[model samples]
Target: MGVIKHQSIRSTLLIYIGFAIGAVNIVFLFPRFFSDTQFALTRLLPEIAIILVPICTLSTVPAISRFFPYYASHLKDKENDMLTLALGATIIGFSLFVLGTLFFKDAIIKANIEKSPLFITYFYLLYPNVFLFSVFGVFESYSGSRHLTVFPNFLKELVLRLLTTVLIVLHYLSWINFDTFLWLFSLLYGVLLLALLVYLRRHKFLYFNFRISRVTRRLLPKMATYSLSLLGASLFTLLANNLAPLILTSSKGLQDVAYLTIAQYMSQLIMVPQRSISAIGLPVLAQAWKDKDKDKIEEVYVKSSLLQLTYALFVFLIIWSNIDSFFQLLPPNYSVGKYVVLCLGISKVIDMGTGLNSQVLSTSRLWRYDLYSSVVLLALSLPLNYYLINHFGLIGTGYATLLSMLVFNTIRYIFIWVKFGLQPFTMSSVKAIGVALVAYFGCIWIPLAIHPFVDIVIRGILFLAIFVTLVLAFRVSGDITSTIYSAVNKIRRRQ
Candidate 1:
């Protein structure tokens, strides 16, 4: 429990730093500098790479999970075998994807992608990005397995974002054209790959033994099988998540897609902590499940839910309360999709509230359920996104996403509850929600009495005070109270 608490705190701080950097990129700079079509490209390109990377990398995650325990024990000998298997799978996946893209070139080009012809060029750029991202996944997975979450967090959340900011600045200064910008974007992945290589070399973990013994050959098939299955699930999930943006761009145009992207970015900010928690939790959960530690698994589930809800609620309140001001910061044209922010924010809050059930399931024996659920989501998402976007534009897309997430999480919650009696919502969960509502409403009135910036600052402080007071007064959780005391002591010590 103490280990989980410590890891969660460290990971949370790292994620917040990442979130701050991401906020600047998404909220302030991208919208301010890029045109609608450019913004859409910026968002969509990454979605394309994210979708492709996991598929190409295949079972890198499960392989990491399987090997991490061994790798931790035998760092010198096993690192090369793991890296060989991971890189080999990545190459094979990339080759197959590239070949498929070549054969289906016309179909892909005619997908009504944003910027049409221009977007097709970006597909080539995705190759390098995909390769680098896939490789980095191995490094990240290795780091997670070793309980070194902060380094990967820094590389992924901070370094990558900082690079984007630098690139944006370079473009602003007339140092790079849009075409060069695309290339530079791909180059950033190369930088990450190099960085990971350097880190591995420094740690003496970058050797490769191409022995191809019977054991190694045998392990390859098993790893490939696992990767393929995980890849299928991942690909479907990506399709479900990105289908709306694709539909919106096809039906509405790039401008509407841009608006949807911004709103989606705003909403996704709420999930930063969730992502952080999932990253730190995945390896730990896998270990627990492997050890058959049911009590530890349940403990992780409950405490993660509580912590996630606490931070998620804080972020949601801050975003919702200052939404108007937030949208006001964007160009008036971009502000049209502001309602999408509210809808998507609600969806993410629901997701965060579910804790790490999906992660636990993904890493446990019931992992096949991810593939089934992803298929269900993909089936539902296409028509839902198509119908909604055709009728409602950007907000319709949000509705489609909200409905999909609601369905997905509800099913997951039911499955976990029925299978393990592992429900995340307790009486305290209900009380926390109630307190959040009170803080949310209470902050609303503060805005009426002051300027937007001042109102935001004041209300933010007030919301924190009220929320803490309510939680403490209500005696929400022994763990949370102790956490607050520890944090306070740390602050006092620093002072």
Candidate 2:
């Protein structure tokens, strides 16, 4: 709990900072500075790489979290082969990816050539993009194994995004051509990869124990089975998530992809707390499962659900409250994504409200169930996305996302509840929602200023005032209020 508390706050803060920079980059800079087609390429390429990186790492990210305890218990600090295993696995996975890419290269180009020529023209850059993300993911996972999540989170959340902001700004200033911008952006992951490596080495967290331990050899069979399940789980889940944009890019065109991309970015704001909590939860949940500590796992489950829902609702309501004002800052064509943000925001709220069920299932004895869940996700998402986008256009993509996520989260929720009797709700859960709604409705009617900025600030301040006061008064989240009290007590003690 202490680790979750300490790290989640910092990680969430840094995540928000990254999102702030990202908001500028995505919401403001990219739309105006880059054309629709160019912006679409930026969004799709990284998305494809994100899906590819997990495959290139053989899903070692989760494997590292779930198995690191075994390595730690059996070997000395520098003698554990976790780092060696992760790095080796990703490189091999990347090699296999290269082989597959050679065969599918023409097919990929042909698939996109009709509607998204920009993506095809820049197709060569995707490999480097994926390779960098692949290695960076490996190190990030290994570092997480050491319970060293903060630095990696910093590098990924803060450093990478800041660099991106700079790159976009550089482009905005016409310092580089679009081709060079695309190339530099792809290579940016390599820069972060280098930074993570240095951070690990300096912290003495870098170790190569290529010598396989008795524990690893014995656990190898179980791990192979676990990895295989998670491998499909990872790919299906990633592919399902990236499906909307990919489908939209190939079927509709890049301009529509650009709108979906911005809306997705906005929706990601609601998920900032989920990212922080999940990253912190991985190693924590893994260790608990390793010890067969149901009590610890449930404590994390309930508290995390409450805390995350609180933060998620706050962010969501704020975004929902000011979405129109925010979009007004963007180009006129971008405003059509209003419904995209709504549908995606509600889906993320439900997703976060369900807490760390996915992590629990993945790390627990019932780990293989994740494979079934992901298969369902892809099975549903593929057909739904294709059909809906072909029919409803951009908002149709949003509808598909909402439906797919609803089904996906519902399946995982049922799995956790039926199998383990753990659920992520409490009385405070309802109270939190009530508080968010009250605050949201409370602020919306206040007059709109002529300037979008003024409207945002006034409504934002009033919304925070109402939301925070009510949350504290009602004790909607004990974790959050307790944190505030603890900080205040420390301040009084110092005085």
Candidate 3:
């Protein structure tokens, strides 16, 4: 928990910084610079790659966290065949990925041409995008297995966003046209992959050890079984999360997809804390299981839940409360995504409240449950997406995602509780909910000014005052209060 907390704080700072850069890109730069179709292409490319990453990496992402402990603990000098297995699987997966993309090219183009014809022009870009991200995921997970979490977060969050901003700015200045801009955008992942490779080499974690002869054939079966199951789980989860963009691009036009992308971006901002904590905590969960330290794992689980819930509620309220003002800062066409923001924001809150449930499960002995849950999520979400998008338009896709995540998290939560006797809720959980509601309602009566910025600042301050005061008074989380108090004391001493 200590290490998780320390790394998570640093990672959170980096992620938020990245989010700041991304907010500028998504809110101001893209809308102001690129046309709607171009903007949708930018967002959709990543979404497509995201949906492909699981299979492209052959589930190496979770495999590293789940199985690395066993290999390192048993093998000499903390060495194992994990990387060799992962990389080998990835090469084969990449081959298949290329073949599959080529085979499905016509179908994909035909499907999107009606509504998002511009996508066909850049369709080949998806292959490279998927390949680069697959390599990145493999290395990132390996780095995480070594407990080198913060750097990967920096690479993904800050460094990548920084690069994206540069490219977008270049595009804005007419230094590069749309095709070059889009290609460079995909290459950002390649740059990050190179950075990660350098990091791994510096740390001497980059050595490749097949170790086929050392480990008995018996262990091979276990490894294969685990990887296959996790691959299914990872694939399903990715599809569920990233499929909305594709569905939107199909049912609605690319412009509507652009709108949904903005809403999704704003909603994802609330997930910084959860993402940071989970990134650092997965390996910790794995180690705890290795040590048979159920108490430590439970501590991590509960603390993560409480902390994320508090942060999630705070961010959601702040964003939603000022959502109108935030949208006003964007172009008028983006206003159509206001409801999308609400739906996705609420869904992210639900995701946060579930804490590190999925991480804990994936790294624990009950990891197989993740496969089942993900299968259910995919099965439920695809049809829901089809039906909802047909009936309700763009925002319906957001609703589909919201409902999918709700069910997905609920299933994970129940399984954790029943199997491990672990749950994230405490008396403080109830108090945190109360605090959020009070702050929301109490600040609702504030008058809106003519200037959206002024209204946002004033209303944000009032909401923060009410929310933080009640949370501290009620001691919703001792960790949060102590940190605040400690910072305050440092300031006082300096004064």
Candidate 4:
């Protein structure tokens, strides 16, 4: 728990730095520098890469978390080289990805050309984008397995965005045209992969002990089954998260997809705390499962839920409370996305409330349940997104997401409870929700006349003060209250 807390705090702070850069890029720069179509293209390209990450990495990321403990114990035997196996598997998976893209290129273009014809010119960039990120994802998992999570977080959350800022600046300076900017933007992932490769090599974790002959027949089948199940689980999870944007690209148009992308970014900002914890927690959870320590796992699950609910609700209220002022800061062209922001913000809040349910199930013997649950959720999401987008447009996509996530998280929670006797709920979670609602409603009527920047700052500070005071007054979460006081005491001491 100490390690989880330490690494999570480091990663959370790093993630927030990344979010600040991304906010500047998405909220300010993209709207200012790129046309709606160009912005949509930028959003769609990385989205395609994200979609392909699990496929091209052959589920190696999750495989690392689930199997690295076993492999670590066998390192002395030099037996079953997990790194070599994962790398070999990734190469084969990437080759398959390329072949599939070649085969389906026409179908893919045709599907998207109607609403997002701008994508046709940059279609070839998709493979390299996926390749780079897939490799990066594999290494990130490997690093996490070694308990070196902070470096990858730095690369992903800080360095990548910093490089992206440089690229955007170059484009704005007219040093590069739009086409070159797109090319360089796609190449950012390639640079990221190299950076991680160098880091791993320097740490001496890049050993290529391909001792495949030493693997037992029993272990081979088990590894194969786990990898394949994780592959399904990862694919379905990506689909549930990303399919709506792709569907919007096809059904609504590039402009609408651009709108939804901004909303998604805003919503994902609230998820940083949970994601940071999960990145650091998965390895711990896997080790716990290996030791058969259900108590430790349950402790993590409950504490993670309480802490995530506290942080997520605070972020949600801040985003929603300042949404009008925030959007006003953007160009009028992006005004339609306020509803998109609101609905997706609620959806993310629901997701963050579930804490690490997916991680718990994925790292436990019940991992295969994730595949089944994700498949059902994906099935539900597709039709709902399609129908809703046709009837209600972009905001309907948010509605579909919210509904699917509510159902998906509910199923996972029930499975965890019934199967493992673990339920991540407490009176503290209830109190946090109560505090958020009160803070939100109480601040909405405070008044608004200043600049959007001033308005957001005033409203945000007021909301935080009110929410913090109430939570502390009610002792909603001791962990959160202690953290607040710790920061205050540190400030006092410095003064």
Candidate 5:
């Protein structure tokens, strides 16, 4: 918990910094510099590749965390075959993907040509985008396994986004055409991969042990089984999540894709704490399971729930409270995504409230259930997406995602509680909900300022004051209070 707390906070701060820069990029720069269709291409390309990353890496993202404890405790880094097998699987998987894409190239074009021609114009660029993304995914997981996540996160969340800002600016200035811009955009992942590689190599945590050691040979069978099963889980879940974007691009065209992308981005702003916490959580759970420390795992589960929910609700309120103002900062067309933001934002808060159920389940002995959960999500979400999107359009996509996530998290919660006697709620959970409601209602009727920025400042500060004060007074999380007090003490000592 100590390391998780320290690193998670650092990583969370870094993620927030990235989000700040990224907000400017997505909300301001891209929209100003590119057309809706071109912006959709930028968004959709990454969507396609993110879906491909897990399969291309053979689900080594989770497998690396799951198996790293064993490999590290038993074998030296030079002899550790975990990374070797991970990279090998990625190479093979990516090769097959390329072959398949080439074979079906005409079919893919046929599907998107009429609706999303801009997407298809740059379709081949997905190869570089997904491959580099896949490689980075594997390395990032390995870095997290070593509990040295802050630096990798800095490169990923902060540095990459900062560089992206430069790329978009270059295009905006007419220094590079869109073609070259897209090419460089795809290659940014390559730069990110190279940076992480250098970091891992310097830290002595990365080496290609293609020569399978005795220990690795013994573990290969289990690792193989784990990776393949998790791959099914990863693929199904990603596909289900993207069903809206895929259907929109094919049916409604890039215009809707643009709206959905922006809405999704807005909703993701609430995910920083959850994202930061979960990144370091897997390795901790893996080691806990290794030592048979059920208590430690349970403690992490409950604390993560409280801490994540506390911030999740806090951020969710801040965003929703200022959503109108935030949208005002964007072009008028993007305002259509208001409902999408609401649906996804509420859904995200619900998932964060459930804590790290999925993370713990993946690292537990009940990992096979992780696959089952994804299958369930796919089954529920596919029909929901088709039905709702047919009826509601882009906002329908948000509703579909929200409902699917609701059921998905419910199922995982049930599974974890039934199997492991572990649930992530405490008394603080209820209090966190109370805090959010109070802050929201307390601020909702406040009239908007003439300027959106001024409205945001006024609303954000009022909400923060009410929320943080109540949270600390209620001791919604001792962790939160202690951290605040610790910071205050440091300030006092410096003064």
Candidate 6:
């Protein structure tokens, strides 16, 4: 528990650091400097890459987890064999993508490029970025299985974002054109891939031992099988997340896509804590499942849910409270998509409130349940997105997302409750919600007596202070209180 808490804190800090850089890039730099077309290109490149990541990685995450314990045990010759297998899988996956692209080149070009003349030339940039990002995902998952997450976190949350920021600045200075920016993105991904390879080599985890025993050979098929199942869920999840942007770009113009992108970026801030918790939770959940530790699983379920909701609600309030200020920071034109923020915010809130239920389902033997649910959600998301985006434009997409999240989270919660009797919320959860509401309203009402910014600052401080005080007063979980005290003591000691 101590280790998990420590890792969670460290990961959260790193992720927030990354988020800060991302905020600058998305909120300030990109929107401020880039034209609507450029911004759309920026957003579209990533969506394409994310969609391609699962296809190119071939669901290497489950394989990495399944194999890492073995590689760790047989650290000498077997490490090389694992590396060899990973490299082989990556190459095969990439080759498949290339072959598919070649076969479907006309359709791909026509669908993505024909409509958006600005993105036509840069559409090819998506390939390398997607390929490298997918490869990085494989390595990150492997590092995660080894309980080595910080470096990957740095690469993901800090390094990549920092690179993007630097590139954006260069563009601002008129040093790099949009084409250069797109090319740089691909190159940056390649650099990260190289860095990962170097790290693996330095740690002696890059080589493949060809000492293929009968057992190891037999395990490959099983690994491949699990990887496929995991891939199905992963692919569907990525599609659901990115389909809105794809549809928006295709149906609407680049300007519309740019606005929705900003909204998506702001909404994503709400999920940072959930992302951090899920990162640590997945491997732990996997191990617990392997051990069949029902108590540990239940403990994880409850604690992770509470903690995630706590942080999520805090972020949600902050975003919602400062929604106007957030838009004020953007250009007047960019602010047109303000409602997209509310729509996406609601979706993320529902998602975070569910805790790490998806992680639990993904890592448990009940993974198939997740696959089924994900498929249903994906099916629902496409039509919903198409309908909403067509009728209501970007805000409609947000509404579609909210609808999808509602269905998905409700189903997951109900299933977890019925099968495992593992409800994430208790009376304390209700108390936390009450505290949040009180703080939110307090912040809103107090502002009536003051200016917006001043009211925001004062009410924000009061909200946080009062919220903490109430949590302490109610004594919701001695562990959480102790953790708070420990953190305070550490800060005091440092001072």
Best by lDDT: 5
For candidate 2, the per-residue lDDT at 299 reads 95
* Candidate 5 vs. true structure, TM-score: 0.98
For residues 1-495, write the lDDT of model 6, one tens digit per residue.
Answer: 455666777888888889888988887788779788888888888788888777787877666765555555545544346655665777788889888978987886687574577877676787787778887888877777767677777778889999998998898899988778788877787887788778877886665555665445757787777678878888888898889878877778678888888888878877877766777777777777777898888888888777777777777787777777666667888777888888888888788877888878877766778878889789889999999899987788888888998998899999999988888887778877887787777676653333545655676787788778877888765556887899899999999
The deviation in Å at residue 389 for candidate 2 is 0.7
Highest-TM-score candidate: 5
The sequence of per-residue lDDT tens digits that candidate 1 reaches over residues 33-98 is 877778778777777778787777775765676545544454455434676767787788788878
Q: How many residue pairs clash in each candidate?
A: 1, 0, 0, 0, 0, 5
Candidate with the larger TM-score of 3 and 6:
3
Candidate 5 lDDT over 1-495, as tens digits, reads 887888888999999999999889989988888999998888888889999988799898899999888888888878887887888899998998999899999999999999989988888899999899898998899889988899888988999899999999899899999999999988998888898889888887778877878877788788888889999999998998888888989888998888888889888878888888998888999999989999999999999999888888888889999999999998898999999999999888988889888889889888999999999999988899888888988788888889999999999999899999999998889999998899989888899899999999999999999998898888888888988998899999999
TM-score of each: 0.93, 0.97, 0.96, 0.96, 0.98, 0.93
Instruction: Please list all clashing residue pairs in model 4, or write none if there are none.
Output: none
TM-score of 6: 0.93
lDDT of each: 0.77, 0.88, 0.86, 0.86, 0.89, 0.78
Model 3 ranges off by over 4 Å:
77-79, 213-218, 492-495
- The TM-score of predicted model 2 comes to 0.97
Model 4 RMSD, rounded to 1 decimal: 1.6
Backbone clash tally (model 3):
0
Task: Give the Å error, residue 175, model 2.
Answer: 2.8
Please provide, for model 2 over 262-325, each residue's C-alpha lDDT reduced to its tens digit, 9 standing for 90 to 100.
8999888888888878888888999998888999999999998998888889998998899889
- Per-residue lDDT tens digits for candidate 3, residues 230-288, read 88998898888877788878878888888888888888888999888887889889889
> How high is the lDDT of residue 131 in model 1?
75
